[model samples]
Target: MGVWIRPEVFPIFGAVGAVVGICSMQLIRNITTNPEVRVTKQNRAAGVLENFDEGEKYAQHTLRKFVRGRRPEVFPNMNKYFAEKQ
Candidate 1:
């Protein structure tokens, strides 16, 4: 038995496949790059110890990623606007 897909619909199939692949890759990257996830995986593989500060440090997502990074502002000029108002 054989099935044939219309030529016009072939592009739609390719686009859907590309979108699915991109989404899956992004999901994997987010999980793998996460500090807490890494810490948990390490703890499991090496066996948990008394001092679990590694995971504790990354327990808070905002604290773990954003505190040391750039300011979480919507617009670049928003900070200036607030500062002048205050």
Candidate 2:
């Protein structure tokens, strides 16, 4: 009885492991490639706003767009935000 059940359980475990591995790889790839997940000095300096409050607003707006799946162009927007400041 035990031997019969062992074979069935092993395959199920293998299938679960494969699914988890694939999902983990995709998550890592997204984190590495997505700009919204990581901020850089260049992005911060690109904003034209001289004040912290204005900068915070711009960042929050960008992040909101990302969260909503709008995929707004972050770098160009940052550049434009700062360019407009001038």
Candidate 3:
């Protein structure tokens, strides 16, 4: 029984890896948002659960939306968090 990776499984493997990576990054982002998750023992923490859709709900109207911003837009404060504490 040599190592075996079925040809069809390659796409599935890539998809799963991408999903896991995105989720892990999101979780890390959520955790880093506020002091409560980092140090404070407060009951209520920062962060909101937002429900949104990509593009729009219909084709008749484009919904006049701007999807996909610059990479930096995803995590505006991530830079500060990673900055040295000097």
Can you give the TM-score per candidate against the true fold?
0.39, 0.38, 0.40
Most lDDT-accurate candidate: 2
Q: Rate the local accuracy (lDDT) of all candidates.
A: 0.67, 0.68, 0.55
True-vs-predicted CA distance for residue 73, candidate 1, Å? 20
Rank candidates by lDDT, best first: 2, 1, 3
Which stretches of model 2 miss by more than 4 angstroms?
1-5, 39-86
Candidate 2 vs candidate 3: which has greater TM-score?
3
Cα deviation in Å at residue 78, candidate 3? Answer: 34
Can you tell me which runs of candidate 1 are displaced by over 4 Å? Answer: 1-3, 38-86
Model 3, residue 43: C-alpha shift (Å):
11
Per residue, candidate 3 scores C-alpha lDDT tens digits across 1-86 of 13587777889999999999999976885576433344454534545323233112322233233443445356658766776544
lDDT by residue for model 1 (1-43), tens: 1257667787999999999999998678567654444446555
Cα lDDT tens digits for candidate 2, 1-74: 89667776888999999999999976885565544444576765676535666445545665476678554566
Task: Looking at model 2, report the run of 10 residues with the lowest lDDT sum.
Answer: 29-38
Lowest lDDT block of 10, candidate 3: 54-63
